[model samples]
Target: MPSIMQRLNLRPIVLAPMAGGPGTPELAAAVSHAGGLGSLGAAYLTPAQILEAGAAVRRLTRGPFAVNLFAPQPSVQPTELEVEQATAELAPFHSDLGLPPPALTTQADIDFGAQLDAVLELRPAVLSFTFGRLTARQMEALRERGILVIGTATGLEEARQLEADGVDATVVQGGAAGGHRGGWLEDELADTLALTRAAAGSVRTPLIAAGGLMTAGDVRAVLEAGASLAQCGTAFLRATEAGTSAPYRAALAAAKAGDTVLTRAFSGRTARGLRNAVTEGIGQPLPYPFQNALTRPMRAAGAAAGRADVLSLWAGEGVAQGQEGSAAQILDGLWP
Candidate 1:
């Protein structure tokens, strides 16, 4: 089966899926309505939530869209030793927030197999993954259901592996991309511009360049570098209909918000975000899920309290390039 890239007849632009509610059904549908592919970040949702989000997008438009999830990695539970290491680092933040030292049990147990089953049942037009590659069985199952599988890659070696693993295409993520990177190959993350073009140089699979992409010029450059399409995440965070919280929106708009910073304090894995204080308290971060879970309460409380400093505020270095508007308006700039 041809990949969704071939099937959709879409414009050479796609709104990349970002986890943590930023890529909502409304945002996805809006971008789809604007003639680019829309997507849902199902990594943080339950199977039912994924189904609901997918169904909502379907109701909004028949234009092809994408469903994205993180390939399940071994739950890296924080060792008591490691937890002590990170927690001590965060003691000051705890004091500032007027809270007790975070307990170690803070973790989420998302059922990955169930989520995959739900994804197959929903049968989205495109199935994409990040953080790591998908298993052969998982790829085959999605293919059998007529879903196009797209793997995320950080460099040329990963792109090569995705093709060898039988994925239909690759979302070539660069260092500039916000949220978790797809670099599984150690020391292989070359510069986004050079790596994305190089990854596509030898692969027959279509390439989708993602990262630090905001303006029409950036879009044109990626296409010129040989990407068949450009996938942008931070560009949509400021869209009016996006699920971005007010603090996140403001952070993106902040004059001081310069290039994105890479920190794992929020989720235990490195992700780019607008530089902020929460990331500054990174020394005490537990491992994935644990650090993510430990800080969940604080981030929620802080966001509800309108505290921008405590939020993850993920975005790329080109944050200064963000503009407040609708998806269509942003697409006008991206595709012009």
Candidate 2:
């Protein structure tokens, strides 16, 4: 049997699987080249794109690389009310871009089955999921193939659930993390959870702390609290090799001295990002892919025009703590 360390090569530091732009082939290869396990955030890619990136990484580095996906967020009703309310929330950007209102026909369109089939076919070294839990049959299929599975949990109950689902490890995403809060429980679903305590008290699977972790001390603090590793996404966002846009990299650096907030204006899921007009003034939109799609054109236009206000700009509450440097240098800081 492969030991846990042998399975993941037990890299104490892990590269965060950032979707959209940051998870480029160069970034993944560089992290793997640096001896840290790299992760390609294949969540947004079509199956073909995911396979292409994985094959490219294989050509560049002979090391462990994880493939991450947003484990199919729950579908929301695709109704006139949902669409009108959601698209109306996007009007400011539509006006700014001088374009007709987007005529969105459907709301939810995430193809989880296709993505899973891609995972099964590609068979990357590790497979990790976010957003929510996996079905028993899905978990069993991956296990049968010797694929190591990691689950994200935002709270105690979620962590326990991950353990029950047979995940080899659980990413203890702190409440302060960027992107989405994958907490499964109600009433207790605060926007976020603190990392250290969440790691120590809940699920026994090896814990990898996420959110607001910007420095080596931060990684150590989580490990001391019982985590086995630390996954730092925001810390690497501005790194030289990261796939973040010029505007985003610049904005992230500029926002480094400012505050971050959790808002659903970007993608319907509450993601932490810099404080901006779009986030603050907006009403709730269509959920998940609908909200994501509704804002896609705007996000594209904003980035093209260097307008940070309309872009997703997803980061943890610790945006102020983000460092500007190379991925290897960032890894050294986190690991050393």
Candidate 3:
């Protein structure tokens, strides 16, 4: 059997699926065309949108690419009081954005099964997931289709679990990683090198090191530590093809390495982003999806008006290393 890297024909560089708005088909394809594996962060996308994104990437490159989705978590039904409190906290921000009062409803996340069906149909070179693990049946289905499955882990235990669940590879997301942390257990954090070494030592699956990796030296360090590839997200945010909002791009340009914090204010899930007013004031909001929905209008308005304070400026600890250029240019700089 071919080694995982040999099978994928990867260039020791993998583009992290940034999800939400920053990840775009054009950006994914551009990176893949450059000999790295491009990935679409499809966690927030509907099934139809996932297919459309795959089509978009196909139009741009025939190289192997990956699509990532969030593993399903049990629904957390917030108390009416919880919803009201979250709404009240966000109401002022909504008003400041010239939007209506926050009115939230019971919304469902995109069906994971449906999303998997679409992914299987599109048959991207790889399918990766975070936040949780896939069941034996899910893994079996993917394997039967000859699709490689990758899972994200933040610690050794999670890495072992993914190996047991039959993931072909795993991404060890370090604390310096931007956006959502990948550990599904409690919030135990470690830097990229530590987690990568730990996972590589503990799991049989090939490891992909992620988080805070900005330069070719950083990539080399992780590979030397036993990672088969390095996946980068924040470093690629400024890529011209990325769907990063103008305000986000500006924030990245202005941010220093330590200017970010991990907070649940934006989406009720702990994610790293540049320190802004929203991350400062908002006390604990509702859980994910709910908090994410409650703040949607404010975020949308913030993006429209180019206001950094109201948008979810998801970035890794390596923001200072990001530069404005095409995805291919950014990849060359990171790998060369």
Candidate 4:
């Protein structure tokens, strides 16, 4: 049988599955139709929504696309004091937005098992996960169905771990990649080329390099460095088919490449993005789900009201290099 990459029929360009909003079904299908693998950032979606999204993508293109989800994370059992502090920290943002005081909920995290069940049923061509690796049983299920598994890694140790766990491929996410950092092993900050070279040397699994990849030349350099393919997120934030908010798109356009800063202010996990008031204001947040949920309403209001300061405008170090075009056009220009 042909390899998974061969089955993908790709153009060495894979969409980076920009969760939160930018990775829309329209964008995914457009990239797939253009001969590159497209991905749905389904981490935040419920099981029903995941199925609906899969159906929507199927309707748009017969080509295969990947569905991405966050691996199951340890539920943060925050102390009452921690919850109080988090709510207090977000209260000002809520007040400014004319919203109710931020409240802590028992159900802040997505149910990964339920989400996995949904993915099994949806059964896209590929399944990619980040933040951690799946269990043996979970990996077995995906393999049994012939769904290629791609796990994210930020360094060599994690890459080896993913291979040991039986992933079909590994996404070597450089520190400069946008959005949440996927490094579970000691907050990896290696450069993309360095990490890719290290993993390519150490692991037998195919490597996908992600981070600050904006042009065909950038992709080529990574490929030469031994990456099998290049995955890009920041480059596609402005694609016409993307669901990026107006304020977020504006921020990306206005940003210099150096404007992005790493902060856990919005999501309670370290992620690189455009610096704003919220990130600067909130220091030492609760954990992932708690912080992500607490700030959701404020972030939603910010996006609605066109306030970039209150929103999480995730981007990479290549902010200045992002292009404005349709997804197809972007893919063509990136790899053609």
lDDT of each: 0.82, 0.78, 0.89, 0.90
Rank the models by lDDT, top first.
4, 3, 1, 2
Which one wins on lDDT? 4
User: Cα lDDT for residue 196, model 4?
Assistant: 88
TM-score, every prediction: 0.95, 0.93, 0.98, 0.98
Task: Report the C-alpha displacement of residue 165, candidate 4, in angstroms.
Answer: 0.9
- Tens digits of per-residue lDDT, candidate 3, 64-108, equal 999999998765867899988988988889888888898786474
Which model is ahead, 2 or 3, in terms of TM-score? 3
Off by over 4 Å in 1: 1-3, 187-189, 255-259
Candidate 3 clashing pairs?
none
> Which ten residues in a row are the worst by lDDT in model 4?
1-10
Worst 10 residues of 2 by lDDT: 186-195
lDDT of 4 by residue, 180-235 (tens): 99968886688998888888889999999999898899999999999988999999
Model 1 over residues 1-336: C-alpha lDDT tens digits? 225556874677888898886999989888888889888888889899999999999898888888898887777666779878877776666777777876666346667788889999999888888767778898889989998888888877888888998887798888878788777777354567887778767898888888889889998998888888889888889998798998778777883545468888887878888777877757656667678877777787777877889888888767788888989899888997
**lDDT of candidate model 4 versus the reference:** 0.90
| Model 2 lDDT tens row, 1-336 | 224456665457778899998778778877888888788998888899888999988898888888999886567666898778777767767997876786575434768778888888888878999988999999988888888898988777778888888898888887778777766564243332354465566556887778788888887887777777777788888888888988787778878544688788877777778888788878867677778877788888887888777787888877877887778888888876
User: By TM-score, how accurate is candidate 3?
Assistant: 0.98
